[model samples]
Target: MTMEFGPDDQIDYDGPVTPYRQLAEILRARIARGDWAPNRAIPSEARLVQEYGPARTTVRRAIKVLVEEGVLFVVPQRGTFVAERSSEDR
Candidate 1:
């Protein structure tokens, strides 16, 4: 099932889920909705922090989770990009 998030969606700081995990899910939904194309870099951590009102560390943690899940991949000097899913990933 695909999950989608709208522009108005905001992270619930006091919600049961941790902020990092919530940010991760929001990003996952954004990716699934094609906010960023495959292999295209996502917004920088600073931009995300400004947009999501999360701390820099929180944004980094969310990105790390996506990377570990193969949803994203980071290029050291560049930035993070959406992973191009293989047929086996379906």
Candidate 2:
């Protein structure tokens, strides 16, 4: 928990989607597969930046989309967490 992304966040950037959107999709799939449990902390902005090579705003946009889509929840002083059983994801 050094507040860094490292190699794990690095992405190949495939397809027509923006890097942030692609990152969102990647996180979404992981959540759907139980890679991240509900209420668990998702990756941080610094990590995402290093991994996706995108601006903070772009990453925020992608995350915002997920929040709007009901795939994530933000807890004060904590962090973003995967929503359990989001209907939008189904």
- Per-prediction TM-score: 0.89, 0.71
TM-score, candidate number 1: 0.89
lDDT of 1 by residue, 1-90 (tens): 434445357798887778888899989888877899899999999999999999999999999999999999999999999999889966
Candidate number of the best TM-score: 1
Choose the strongest candidate by lDDT.
1
Q: Pairs clashing in candidate 1?
A: none
Query: For residues 11-84, could you state the per-residue lDDT of candidate 2 as single tens digits?
Result: 44664556666667767766766778887878887777776687888788888988998889888888888887
The global Cα lDDT (0 to 1) of model 1 is 0.89
Ten contiguous residues minimizing lDDT sum, candidate 1: 1-10
